[model samples]
Target: MHLNRFDDLAADVSRGLARRTSRRSFTSKVGVWLFGAVAAPLLLPVARGRAEDRYAGEEGDPRSCDYWRYCATNGYLCECCGGSANECPPGTTMSALSWIGTCRNPADGKNYLISYNDCCGTAQCNRCSCSRHESETPVYRAGTANDIHWCSANESTAINCTVAVVLGAAEDEV
Candidate 1:
């Protein structure tokens, strides 16, 4: 008898819900929620913009994202913020810790170890923003990943720009 009573109550609740909303309305609401869940995260990154066009051979500009040294970089270029590719801006200091990348210099045709260091101090330099995902690694392998804030170890964690310093040419593996 108790089971029968619970079933009748459940049927009444379902009938009321069905009367209150149409199938089209329910599906449209679900679709909107699903779209928001999927697409919202893509817009959350701090940087937004298309990467600069890649140049052929050794002619690419350092200020652009397609430059040889920035093969795995994912931040604003220091070259656009009153600094060269290998140096931090005037006031900001380069973080000691850096994410590493191996990039082939178009001019030399040799792979070099590029240390992507972040300049910390002021707010982010919103200029020349670009992200090159070449040889990107998972976040678990933090040393090889470029999509993280590398300025966290400094006095001021505010990242201004990133400089890709060439450590040395990478030796060929046997």
Candidate 2:
């Protein structure tokens, strides 16, 4: 008996369809609802808290630019103005546009994802000189590049300064 590739494929597809049809009958609407009711309680605690809290850090001084949170930071310090380490200055709007930087957190010694958002409608705060480049790239590749001015979308003119805000820690790949 000689069997071709197409014959083997057809037999495999037929077996798959038979198994799917059999399995489909077992998963009814009532079964799905019952599964959710039983699983929701077990999963609630894992999903209840804010995901951002997992990357919270208590290290680094806001006044200094070379603080631990500013490991991969590239911009003017918000602390120089009225803003703290993770906030925009008063009267200045934090631009939704930002660059992602993988900064090393000294507290936990892990790389955290930091969003360097530009504070619009304000002059540049030239106090701190924190320019830690970890995975920074050139202006042509603006997605991961922190050197480029990221305030063009919010403000009409050039970017005044930038603020390093912790978005979250980098999760390990499974």
Query: Which predicted model would earn the best TM-score?
Result: 1
Task: Supply candidate 1's per-residue lDDT for 95.
Answer: 94
| Model 2 lDDT per residue over 25-144, tens place | 233222323334544454334323312332345553555543556656666677777787778887888888778878777667777787888888867666564565668888787877
Model 1 ranges with Cα > 4 A deviation? 1-59
Candidate 2 ranges with C-alpha deviation above 4 Å = 1-56
Candidate 2 matches the true fold with a TM-score of 0.61
Model 2 worst lDDT run, 10 consecutive residues: 20-29
Where does candidate 2 clash, by residue pair? none
Score residue 80 of candidate 1 by CA lDDT. 90
Give the winner by lDDT: 1
lDDT of 1 at 5: 52
Count of backbone clashes, every candidate in sequence: 0, 0
